[model samples]
Target: ACDVFSIRAQTASPPAAATAAPAQTANAPGAPQHFGRSAGNGPAAATGLWDYFWRGLTENYFNFAGRARRKEYWGFCLFWTIALVVVVGAGLFIDDTMGDPDGSELPVVTVGLCGIFLLATALPWIGLNVRRLHDIGLTGWLFLVVFLPTIGWLIILVFALIPTQARENQWGPVPTGVGI
Candidate 1:
């Protein structure tokens, strides 16, 4: 009878392990006890400008399923802007250094290098934009707004500046700890 009662009780209630708090690591006195490695914690956090840019170019390259934080989008933009300036400056320098005294023709090497750089980065740029749109709770197809001229650029800029959704929508997980 006791065995039968014990078995019945065990089957009726959840196990103690299931109700217990998640295990946490011991930390020094007054130190913060980290639960897990989230986007906001540890050295792997994407908070840094360079980290956002490099991750977008590599880890998230061509990834269109998840949301992107504002920092990630803007960091990539900042990197692209700096790269553009450098590439243009280098091309101009090369042209000036190699061009003939008579400036009648274009600099082939400078044009070629700039063209190659633009071509190489084009897909990643599009992917970043798409993810940026996704961050703001919009579909990636809305990236076509870039083609509508002045207003389109303004719209896309607004979209990029907008904060990411605080929770996951149809898209994948939130990019930061601020959202669910």
Candidate 2:
């Protein structure tokens, strides 16, 4: 049986193209190679708003190395805000429809759902904020600005609005389609 299989294999022949070596193009002098997108051509350019936001939440859930563009940061904020609103609405609905009169004033399901949502998103929230700061050429530690009181929150708001750095800095390369 082995001899028969070997004989059949030897008789079979691959196509000429498959057997031939692929043509290789030599780079012209000073020609760019393997360089990613040019300026103003990042993921935000190719993906929809929801995709950009979801990518930030899922892809960079724990990523702290790269720079996040304004779209990515704001996209997340938009989705997160909408989700929070929805969660609040659900909680209110649950409180109105399912809460026990004899139980504590607060609805247990509502509180539980809200708490779970916040806890689930806490890490991604922090990670995105840190990356957003990195995009503006500031260190992630700047997130501490949120802890300062009334002024600290104002500062954080300002930081969130600041545009992405046009050029690459200490963080990874400038995000595509950002600051262009």
Candidate 3:
């Protein structure tokens, strides 16, 4: 009887383990999560607002083909912003005729170019940010908080400071390093 009992126990344990194994390897259901993971590598991708702007506009303009990592997207925004300032400054300096005080056609052109650059830098991110929020299952209307001056600024600051949700979310999968 003891031998029979022991054999039965062993057989039960194997079946239990077999049942558990599938659950352990089971994939979770839902959209892929993509938050706070921007350290993979495939290609350098673009490194600024302008770079991503041109690329996204030309390639991903209307193409919501894949998810975008917030860190990389935001990082590009920062880099291009600095680059924009520097490039605009250099352009103005060059337009100044090596340090002339009088304003002229060159200055006008420089100012116009700077305005265009600023617009180009701002436009795409606005759309991208909305799309990002949409991926997170949030409405793009939240972006309007930025228009409220202090309130908007505070709202954006809070959003930026928060950690992105991990795991697959409604935004699909977290973007891989290739800036997909």
Per-residue lDDT, model 3, residue 6, is 82
Q: Is candidate 1 or candidate 3 better by TM-score?
A: 1
- Candidate order, lDDT descending: 2, 1, 3
- Please give the CA lDDT of all the candidate structures: 0.76, 0.76, 0.59
Q: Model 2 segments beyond 4 Å from truth?
A: 1-46
Q: Which lDDT tens digits does candidate 2 get at residues 1-180?
A: 469888988899967996897645436566444322233323434555687678766776787766777787778888888988899889989888876788778777778888998998888888888888988999999998889978987887898899888876777667776545
Evaluate model 2: give its lDDT: 0.76
Instruction: Give residue 50's lDDT in candidate 3 (0 to 100).
Output: 58
Model 3, residue pairs in steric clash: 32-168, 32-169, 33-167, 33-168, 33-169, 145-152
Q: Which of 2 and 3 is ahead in TM-score? A: 2
Using lDDT as the measure, the top candidate is 2
What lDDT score goes with residue 165 in model 1? Answer: 88
Model 2 lDDT-worst window of ten = 33-42
Q: What local lDDT does model 2 show for residue 23?
A: 49
Model 1 ranges off by over 4 Å: 1-45, 177-180
